[model samples]
Target: MTNPTVAELIARSNRLGADPANTNYAGGNTSAKGTETDPVTGEPVELLWVKGSGGDLGTLKPEGLAALRLDRLRALVDVYPGVEREDEMVAAFDYCLHGKGGAAPSIDTAMHGLVDAAHVDHLHPDSGIAIATAADGEELTGKIFGDKVVWVPWRRPGFQLGLDIAAIKRAHPAAIGCILGGHGITAWGDTSDEAEQNSLWIITTAQAYIDEHGTAAPFGAVRPGFEVLPEAERHAKAAALAATIRGLASTDKPMVGHYTDSAAVLEFLASEKAPALAELGTSCPDHFLRTKVKPMLLDLPADASVEASIARLIQLHEQYRADYAAYYQRHADDASPAMRGADPLIVLVPGVGMFSYGANKQTARVAGEFYVNAINVMRGAEALSSYRPIPESEKFRIEYWALEEAKLQRIPKAKTHQGRIAFVTGAASGIGKATAARLAAEGACVVIADLDLEKAQAAAAELGNTDVAIGVAANVADADGVQAAIDATLLAFGGIDLVVNNAGLSLSKPLLETTEKDWDLQHDVMAKGSFLVSRAAAKPLIEQGMGGDIIYISSKNSVFAGPNNIAYSATKADQAHQVRLLAVELGAHGVRVNGINPDGVVRGSGIFAGGWGAQRAATYGIKEEDLGQFYANRTILGREVVPSNVADAVYVLTGPELSRTTGLHVPVDSGVAAAFLR
Candidate 1:
């Protein structure tokens, strides 16, 4: 018979409720066929269109499929777990996906590309209830389909799953597709019809089996309990638990375990089956990597001692660590030191569901999902037979395999600007402009703050459609103006990442000859201005949770104290100290505060003006033309200090490359200050 039509198959899939419902806000996606441009050649190629972020599969239209370039996607899959190189991959894919040759790639593009079928279809089918719910799924699977199907245990989808599929293709070249135990299924074919048929067959077969044997009644129930504690007592208990978890993990932010009233959970705890339930972990082995083999079940009277409850939790956690260590040791290779270390990614609370932990939020979420799904599956599976995951040996190999570990290694832990943001003050001019430009070039959303409103706007315009730069005007000494600048920055980009306090005024004056008005004028813009801007920027930086960097632009005069420069010297000294105080106060928030002291910067309007440069040259007894050489020769490297040099110092503190060193005074004076000391 002729292959079923794509429309007909999709309609049938919808009728069977296999496709995600468009009206169901959280339902999944669908796709179509089209073409996109090639990034390298700017040529159009055939593409299998996919839904955009918000499109629902049930009501999906032809427009929903994004027309992604299959060839480009295939290339990306070959480089599995290549998130670190996502920028390059995305750029290429966008060119191929949209025919734009420079658009952004979709987040799911990688997964869609690697499926290796003409019309690949995927969804979290409710038939997940069948495979996941079956406690004796392995035997049940055998009884159901025998050798016609392959059973691959559950692994977190995305890079790891993709990589595993690639490996399976290499090993069992004829295997059509595999069941992702406790998760979902993948069906593919040369045509959309074939793919949908495969999917329908899988779902219907599973449904038939579940309909025949699945239990309808709740397996267990939890009894009610009461807690009569004062508000203060409850607050104290939560705070103490939060603190304890944080301390144990050496992290400031830990998952705060929640108190739940699930009857299923309470009944499970009160039942004689609790110990047996603890012995068998989540339904599938994949969950072992998440919630561990067991949860910490708390069993105590409502009025039981608080200390006793806490002590039990602590003891369970310690036991988890010990068990995890033992598992690692047991499976670890004797010859390899690196192979002998691993830890539990999750903790199970007996009466509570599960508490997943990770170095960051995304990882924690993944762990939590795995645990919840696994528990539900195990409970269902218990009805058929005892719930048993893959052998520990197999789990150890899957978890510790250098290839699988390599997959984890491939995922970028953090994007380039993971923790920091940058603001470049006085960004319209020579040093300031270059500094702002450099910060943007290094992944910072550089906010160009300057008194020269037009110049700042011009500088931003020059950056040319770069998402990493914004221009704002502010007289740094005006508290409201500074605050407004910061507010605008937050509105534009969520939060402030870094502050390049480069906006300042300079004046040359003799010590006794300087008037109070002149001293105040110089200090107001240089020292006081930097202080005000930093103060305004601090609140949002702290709220960002990733500490921040504040770089004060002090001059070399602060260190190489010179004749007739009393006002400049005093102000620079105060600004440098301000950075020190900022470092101390904001360190807890993870902010790194520092100062860059530059001298003899060539090509600038403020201090390097015609008369000022000539006068400074005369003071050193050098000709105006020879000033550049004079300053250049003063440094050990014989390099002239420029705006780019100062910008480099700012970049170092804000970039992902530096993680530890902070609260420093970096001299970008071409060694001029050191020369004076010598």
Candidate 2:
């Protein structure tokens, strides 16, 4: 028997969606444009056509199919700002569609553009959606596909989404395709038939799972019971909840707006659910990854004061952070530092649903969706049996799995100066000297900016590579000197890659005894110097395209108010805030700004030798040597974290390895703060 042709398979796939109810208009579309471009020929090529937008696969037509230039589409994989330049991108689509004139490209044009396969097919399979919509979908997915399929959790579809898909394709070149959780499935093949078959296989597999597990009764039927409050009372209750959530979230994004007059949601909230509605995540884990596992739950009696209720909520959040830290440590092995790090999970309100938080928008959205899904699954599972989530230990393992850790690990290692020039303030000794050495080791051409020209040059000579290291003497607090230093850096190495705002003086004086002169002097060297240097380097870093990294070496005292070091601590705190604001502003441009709060990086210069250390040690009733040991012993790790430890952290953030991380204040104080308080 002759094999079915591409036309036959396309027809078969279309026929399978013939039922009008199954193929809702505008709900599903198919396209036959093989919109991939050949890298070598630079000519139009056709492999397999796809269904155009708004055309149901059930009745797709040849005219509905846009025959595309495969090579041209492939070329788009490497495009930048992806679809942020929609006009140009859409115009390219127009050219791809028309040759001279073709049918408009599918709405999933970017999706098709990213795939390298000759034939591609996409569908919002109902069964697939049903399965994806479940809370434990990931577990169910594992049970169903085992290791056969790759699952991409829900992500907003567009340019970035396409980039993510392209990355996945590159990583799993052999994957038949992928299932986008909470969205749909994508199947690609050497031939159109195989792609369609894979799509069918995924849908049928999901259908089989649904048949075995049974469908959830409509929410209205299984909905838990709750008191129907008066409209005025409901409004008051919701307002209180919203205020609590906003206070915890530090955002006013109308989280509680969705719950106003929402009795069904309110019922879910006020129910006697085991996990408590606030503790349950959103519809999916993706949401949890962003909003966290819970939101602030305000369960005070109606007569309770709002201020008091808020205080209780803050206390709850503290407890949540503590619990999460304990949970992380309980399951994490000794091997991974990442496992030991603290990340905000979910914030929960007693009578409200959870809200997740993450480092960025994409992560936040994923967390929200995941939370919603998790809630739905847990509620549904309750009907079948007890809704037992995976053991906390298991959740911890999954959360901190080596594979996930690997994703965090994949950050680009700081490249050897890859067009990045760095200016290290106070580069002669202590943490500044170590930072300069670390940056040089990572390939950044270094400019040792210091007050002492001789010592700076000596430090540069010690680095040994004259080609990569240059020494310059300048008072960082002087605006003109900073400008000159920046100019010199540009002349030596085309552009600046990083700046170590590590120059500062630590004065030990009680707040009452700190003279105005002393305060101003401390600020001049630390805060003013940082501002001057950063202002000078900003333009060049922005122009470099590859975002720049700035590391402000702050102090643990910034977070914890330490006696007799008020001047030094206040400036460090301001520096940390400066980095935070910088991160928020510079993030859009790819530049990352963060701080390293090191406790006691012993080894030469700065506060340690300036008599300040001895004074601080005396005040604390300990000798200088004992002060270092005291801090080390006060940490969870019980290791004396050296200047190199702090330097390594700076390198991690500014280097390639932590490209996605920014606006973070990493404590390199051997977890001293964690030991002392939170």
Candidate 3:
């Protein structure tokens, strides 16, 4: 029989994880005790299904729950003192796994399992944690929750912590939950709803108390508003700033940087006491492992040029790296752990909002989300009293703890473009969307720049709505629009590593029949637009000093003849020559320029959407019934080319396969004779 308790636990865990105020990323866990029939004996067994390690509560599923034999887990509590004393309890939980496939349960599983309640929720809501870790946390927890909540001081999480929790439970049998001073909170109930209610009750009560009487961040300076610029200018300035962060934090490969300058974020950054507030460390302890204790702080000058500011930022980052190394050495214990990566995940840029860096957008987004939450909790803590988090030594313990460190270290390797960024023009549809999707799949952040902002955003969401794909309103023919698009890409993902010049409009008409308007439009988009976008992107690629790619989306018509296609052919011809010329020039700057000539990619493509394809198929003498297959059979390979086929060809040119082969023209038309590079 399906245990309703487990399903309820999963539902409640997701609810808590969904709210950043409740949990950030995969920080909390939920568990339920229920009788599940054993497959072998067909008898009910006492099992504990707890939230598995690294499983975020908001997205928790039944499969994500780890099942353990509660009887076996409890039995090992007494054997720990006689055994090695270290890891015996943790090992017992691992050994009691009902079957394989489920992730190892969190270190708190034993602690949760020891709870007698039918349901439990362990959360680290920011506001609640702000009160729990407050200087008068223990006293305040009692003052607010009274006998409803028990107070437990900070204790290292492990077998010993489990025992401590069990003892607390014996004394506070009537208490709904316990607030761990300088840590988190735990709630229990007869049902999952009750357990979640207890957790929410504690959080709401603490937050209410803090709101009613909290203190501001302690700084002996007046609050000052930062210099606010218009939206376009602010994001442009933010892009320039993000580029520097990427350069500073990256050791071997550059980290992708993301900027946030929302009103709330900017207000937090502009606070005169912001620097001191950032130094106090994260509002929650778990973030110590994610963002470190404090962020890398920078005071960006208003009058400084982007170049000079970047130079200064790099210099400051050098000193910051050394200081971090010294901090590690100062805290080194007999274990003598090797220094962790020195890259600062969070960077506080005064006058602008904070910038976050990660190998990819997902990681950066998580860090950014937590930092914003920390801002809220810190402000609340400031209002109630001076915000106090775990000490640096304790953070060191959490950061370097064997269990936590082990959890982070054992993971999959990076993809080829793990930290790289890509920008695709006309990415709202057709081959461009396919290209952006491919790049995102390979771990490169993608920017979808198209003429239609709404469609671009929709396409980006289709690719992945996780902020990895950014959408911009771009008119490739307009210089300012193209510049804004580039700026949007930079603001969203630090810098551009690949620029696919695929934004073009086609008009198939004979030289004599082509109207002047049609001729100019085709030329402006296919030829002039490519030049403008490539030129705009060249500056940043050169500034980053990182080798990049500039691939033009040419057509088979550039080399082959097509009836009544003079405008399309001429524009494409210009593209082919432009690629060869750009390859020669950009090659010196370590940017490899290439082109993909695709033929007859009709389905779901801009060219076929009531434009050139329909006209060409109508003009052809072949029967209308077989127009779609006309070009497919005309090709030597007799295969219909799709957007993905062109995308794959473009990837080959930009990826490692053709690193030494620039000025290359790849034919993605399943073997074209006349379109072959001569």
What is the number of backbone collisions in each predicted candidate, taken in the order shown? 21, 75, 8
lDDT, candidate 2, equals 0.61
Q: Which of 1 and 2 is the better model by lDDT?
A: 2
Q: Which ten residues in a row have the lowest lDDT in candidate 1?
A: 18-27
Candidate closest to the true structure, highest lDDT: 3
| Per-model CA lDDT versus the true structure | 0.59, 0.61, 0.79
Against the true structure, whose TM-score is highest?
3
Q: Compared to the true structure, candidate 3 yields what TM-score?
A: 0.92
Ranking by lDDT: 3, 2, 1
- lDDT score at residue 392, model 1, on the 0-100 scale: 65
Off by over 4 Å in 2: 1-418, 674-678
CA lDDT, candidate 3, residue 332: 76
lDDT tens per residue, model 1, 1-678: 312333543453354333321112223333334444566788877665544443445654444445565666676656644633343454455555544322133444554556555555554454543464355565666676555445666653445455565565446555455566655555555666666666667667765666677665323444344333344453334333332332333223222122222444434444445556666565343455445545545555434454676677667657766776787788778632364323344443333233455443334444555555554455545545555555566566546644445445655655455323467787888788888778666545667888877777788878754244668898987888887677666544435667888876655657677899979987888888898888877765664455667888887877776767788789988988898898889888888888888877767645566366776777788788777778889787788888888888777766657767676788887777442422
Residue 629 displacement (Å), model 3: 3.2
Per-residue accuracy of model 2 over 1-678 as CA lDDT, tens digit each: 312343654575576566422223333444344333455677645644556544556766556656566556666656655444543554466555433333556546767656666555566555555555555666766777766567777654445655667677778876776767655667766676676676678778766666567635422332233334555554444344432343344321211112222333444444556335445433322233334434545455434455675677677666666766776677767853453333344443333343443332223333443444444444444433334333345345435645345545655653544434578998888888888898777666688989888999999899865555779987988998887777666544434668889888877889899999999998998888898888877765664444678888887877887778888988988898899888988888777889988887655756678777788788889988777777678787898877788778887787657888998888887777542424
Please identify model 3 stretches exceeding 4 Å from their true place: 81-88, 216-232, 301-308, 332-340, 561-564, 618-620, 623-628
